[model samples]
Target: MDKIINWGILGCGNIANKFATDLQTVSGSVLRAVAAQDLDRAQNFAKKHTVERAYSNYTTLVNNPDLDVIYVATTHNFHYEHAALCLAANKAVLCEKPICVNAQEARKLVELSREKDIFLMEAMWTRFLPAVIRLKKDLDSGIIGTPQLVQADFGITKPQEAGSRFYENKLAAGALLDLGIYTINFANIVFGSHPERISGYAQFTNQGVDQLSTYNLLYSEGRQALLSAAVALPTPHQARIYGDKGRIVIDDFYHPQQYQIILNGKKPQQVDEIFDGFGYLYEAREVQQCLLGGKTESMICSLDETVAIMQVMDDLRKQWGLRYPNEN
Candidate 1:
C-alpha cells in the first residue's frame, strides 16, 4: 500500500489555498492541518479546504507529530522564520519560491535542514511542470544544439493600495522577488548554472520596492540570459531558448502548458501538456516520492541550488541597491 503523506500548511494565505486545492489531487496526500496568525482566518481556511485541524499559532502546527511534512506558504518576509520552525521540528519542507529574502538566510536554512536530516526543497513549481521537464530533456538531447541565450519575462498588474503586499517594502514586496524569480530560475534551468556576472537595473516605487526590473546574465562560454519582471504592469510572460540549431518558445514559461521548437531547416514542432488543478501537484508529488523513498532533497530543485538561486538574487539586489526592511 502507498504510504500517506500528511501535510501541514504554515500559512493560510492565497498561495496556501491553491496548494491545498492541488494537494487533494495527489494520491496518498492529506491536508492534515493549516495555521495562520488569526484564529478566525485559520478556521475559515480549514473549513474551505476541509483541513483536519487549524491553529492560530505557527509553533503548534509545526509540532504536530502526525504531519509528515509542512508547506511554508507565508509571505516572502516570513519564509525563513516559518520554514526554520518546521525544519527544527524535523518536518520535511516544501518552501515557496525565493526560499528566503536573500542568500544569507537561505544558507542558514540549508545548513539547518542538513543538520536535522530532513527534506528541503524550494517549490519552484516551474521545474517540475511537464512542459518544462520535456523542454529540459529536449535541450539535453541536443535537438537544439548548443543553447546560447535565454529570454523570459514575468509581470503582473496589481493595485498599489496602501499596505498591499505587492508594493510594501515591509512585506518584502517587489517585482523581483514576487514575479522576476520565475524568469531568473528559467534561465538557471536553461543554462544549467548560475551566472558568472550579473548586471541589472530596477525602477522602484515610492515605497522603495522594485516596480520594474531587468537583468542581463553572463554565463560561462559566453552564454547569456536577458530577463525582466514587473509589478503594476503587464509583460509578455513568454520564454525562449536560443541555440545554434534551433530555438524553443513557451508562451507562458512560468506556468507553461505548451512549447514550440523551431529548428534550423525544419518545421516548428509544438508540444502540449495538460494537468488538473493549478499545476502545483507535480511538486507536491515529488515531495511525496522523496519521503517514501527516504530521500532528503530533490535533485531537480536541491537546497544547494536554492541557495545558489538566492545568491543570484542577492547579487542583483546589491547591484540595484535594493534592500527590504529586515536586511542589514
Candidate 2:
C-alpha cells in the first residue's frame, strides 16, 4: 500500500472546512495542519479537525516538513501567491477554483509547477462529481451527437456590504469569477474548445463589483453557449446540451443531485447518484492518485484547461469593465 499524503490547509475558511471534512472519507489522505491570518482562527480550525499543528502565518505552514501537500483555499486574488509559495517550498498544491485572478497568473503558476516538477491541480470539484463524470461519458458515447447548444446558469442572493468579499472590488469578488466560472466551465466541457467569439454584459453594485451577468459564447463550429450568473437572484444552477440525435439536461448541474437524458423525442431517463461527504471526496481521491503515480497535474482538469478558463474569465471581465486592484 502506498503511504498516505499529509495535507496542510492554508486559509481556515468555509471551503477549507468542507475539504477537511471530505478528506476524512478518503483512505490515503490526512489533514495534518492548517494556517490562517488570525492565530485564533487557525487554532480553532485545527481543533475542530483535530489536526496537530496550526500556524497564524501561511509561510510557516508551507515550511512545515511534515506536510506532503498544501490545499490553497484562499480567495481568488491570493491563489497565485499562496500556490506559488507551496510549490516553491517543494510541496504539491490543490488550489481552489478561479485558480488565479487572470490567465497571466495561471500561466505563471503552471510554468513554475513544471519547472519545480511538483504536482498541482485546480480544485474544480464539480468536474469530479459522479454525475459530471457520467455526463462526460454520455457525451463521448454520442448519445448527444454533435452538440449544438449548451446552456447553464448559477446565481445567489448576497447582501450588499462594503466589507463583504462578495461585493468588494479589492478581493476580486463578482458574479463572473464566483458564480460564472461554474457555468463557463460547464460550457467548456460540452463545447470542448474555447469560444472564438465571446461577448457579455454585467450589472455592477455600488462597490464596483458585478452583481449579475449574461454571456454568449460562439464557437467556430457553429455551436453556441448561453451562460448566466448572478449574485442577487436564485437560478436553477442547471445545464442543458442539445445535439443532433438527442439532448441531456443536468438538473442542478453545477452540483447536480439528479439529471435526465431525453433521446429523439422519447421519454426522459433519470440518473440518480448520491454523494458522500460534501462532494469533495472525489477531488481528494484524484489528488491521492496523482501523487501515487508521480504525475504533475490532473489529466481531467489540467493546467492548460485552467489557463483557458481563466482567459475566458479575463475576456468577460474586459467586456464588463471589471478590474481587480492587484491588476493595477
Candidate 3:
C-alpha cells in the first residue's frame, strides 16, 4: 500500500491512449498493463506508452493481482461486460461514459461492484475538468440563482457511410448515445436532478441508428433543458445555464478550460482554467485518491448517475424507434 498504485487499461483505443498519457502526469499512479482483443494492437499500445505488460485477452489483464484498478475504454457495447469482468475479478473499474447501452446493464455492473467491495465509476471526465469545477462552485453559491433553463448542443458532421461506427446499430452507435449523453450529463450537473418528463426525436440513418437527435427535458416546476446532438451536422459544442440572476456560458464544454458568467446588469466576466494536458489528469487523480482512501464510488460521477443517464438514452432511443441488435 505504500508504493505507487498500479493501473491496468482494458482497451487500447484512442481514448485509452489519452488516459495513459495523462496517467503519467499523476504522481501516485503507474500504468502496469494494457489489453485489447487484438494482441498486436495491445502490444503496440503498450510499446508506445511504455506499459509493463500487454495481453490480447481482457480477463488476463484484470486477473493480474498487482493492478489496483482498471480503466474500461472499449466501445459502448463492451463497457458493461468488460467492467463486470473486472469487478468479478475483484478489481476496481473506471468505465468510459454512458456506463452501458441500457440502464439494466449499468445497474447490474454497479451492483456487482458493490457486492465485490471494489470501486466503480463512470469516466464522466467532463465533471472533473478545471473549468467545470469552478462552474459547479458558482452554481452552488447561487451565482446563477435558481437555474430555470439550460441549453447545450453537440454535433459532428461525418460522411454517411454504411456500417460506420457513428450509425451502425450493431455497434450501438447513435447520436444519442455517443453525443447526446454529454448534453444530458451537463443538464444533470447543473440541475442536480433527473428530468421528470422526457420527450425527444431522432433522425435515423439507413442502418437504423440515430443520425441526429433533438429533445427537450422538463425538470421539476417546469424548469427545462433543451438538448441536441447530431452525427450528420455541425452544431455548437457549447452550453448555457440561465438563472434569474445571471447566466453561465461555456464553449467546447466537454473538456472546457474556460467559461463566462454574465450577470443581469453587468458585463460578461471570463474565468480561465489552466491545465497541462487534455485535462484527463484530474480524473486519473480522482481514481488514485479513491483507491488510496478505500472508497468504492466517486462523488463526482456516481454509479446511480451513470445509470440514470443510460435510462434517459434508453427512453430517447425508444422515442425514436431505434433499437440495437443486442437489445432486441
Candidate 4:
C-alpha cells in the first residue's frame, strides 16, 4: 500500500482552495489541516475540504504531529517566513511561487531546509504539468535541437487601488515576482543555467509597484530569452522556443491547453494533454510521491533551481531600483 501523506494548508486563499480541490483528485494524499488568520475562514476551508483540523494561528497548525507536509499558500511576501516555520517544525513544505521576496531570503530557507533535513520546494507548479513535461521530453529528444531563443509572457489587467496587493509595495506586489517568475523559471528549465546577462524595464504604479515589465536575458552560449509580465493588461500567456533545427510553441503557456512542435520544412505537429480539475493536482501528487520516497526536494523543482530563479529576479529588481520595505 502506498503511504498516505498528510497535508496541511497554511492559508485559506484562492490558491489554497485550488490545492485542496486538487488533493482530492490524487491518491496517497489527504488534506488534514488548515490555518488562517481568521478562525471562521479556517473552519470554513477545513469543512469544505473535509480537512480534519483547522486553526486560526499558523504555529498551532505547524505543531500538529499528524501533518506530513504543509503547503504554504500565502502571498508572495509571506512565503519565506511561513515556509521557515514549517521547516523548524520538521515538516516538509511546498511553498507558493516567488518563494521569497529576494534571493537572500530564499537562500536562507534553502540552507535551513538542508540543515534540518526537511523537504522544501517552491510551488512552481507549471514545471510539473503534463504539457511542460512533454515539452521537456521533446527538447531532450533533439526534436528542437539546441534551443537558442525562448520567449514567454503572462499578463492580466488589474484595477488600481491602494489596498490591492498587485499595486502595493508593502505586499511585495509586482509583475516581476507575481507573473514574470513563471517565464524566468521556464527559461531556466530549458536553458539549464542562469543567464549571463539580464536587462529589463517596467512601468510602475503610483505606489512604485511594477505594473508591467519586459526582460531580455543573454546566455554565454549565445542563447537568449525574451520574457514579459504585466498586471496592467491582458496577454495570451504564450511561450515559444526557437532552436537550431526547429521550434516549439505553447499556446497559453503559463497554463497551456495545447502546444505544437515544428521542424524545418516539416508540418507542425500538435502535442496536447488534458489536465484534471485546476491543474494543481500534478504538484500535489509530486509532493506526495516525494514524501513516500523519503526525498527532501522535488527533482522537478529543486532548491538549486528555486535559488537560481530568485537570483534572476533579484538582479532585475536591482537594475530597475525596485525594493519592498521588507527587503531593507
The top-ranked prediction according to lDDT is 1
Tens digit per residue, CA lDDT, model 4, 1-328: 9878999999999889988998898988888899999999999999999988999999999999999999999888888899999999999999999899998999999999999889999888889898888788888888889999999999999888777878888889999999999999888878877898999999888889788999999987889999999999898898999998989999878777679999989999998887888899998888888888888999899889899889999999998999998676
Which pairs clash in the backbone of model 1?
none
The C-alpha stretches of model 2 lying farther than 4 A from their native spots are none
Give a tens-digit lDDT track for model 3, residues 4-26. Answer: 88999998988899989999889
Q: lDDT score of model 4?
A: 0.90
Clashing pairs in 2: none
Task: Count clashing pairs, candidate 4.
Answer: 0
Candidate 3's clash total is 0
Candidate 3 at 176: error in angstroms?
Answer: 0.9
lDDT of 2 at 1: 77
The parts of candidate 4 lying over 4 Å away from their true place are none
Q: What root-mean-square deviation over C-alphas does model 2 reach?
A: 1.1
TM-score to native of every candidate shown: 0.98, 0.98, 0.97, 0.97
Prediction 2 TM-score vs. true: 0.98
- Tens digits of per-residue lDDT, candidate 1, 1-328, equal 9899999999888899899999999999999999999999999999998988999999999999999999999889988998999998899999998799999999999999888899999999999998889889999998899899999999889999998888999888899998888888899999899889999999999999899999999999999999999997898899999999989999989989999999988999989986668999999999999999999999999888888878888898998889997788
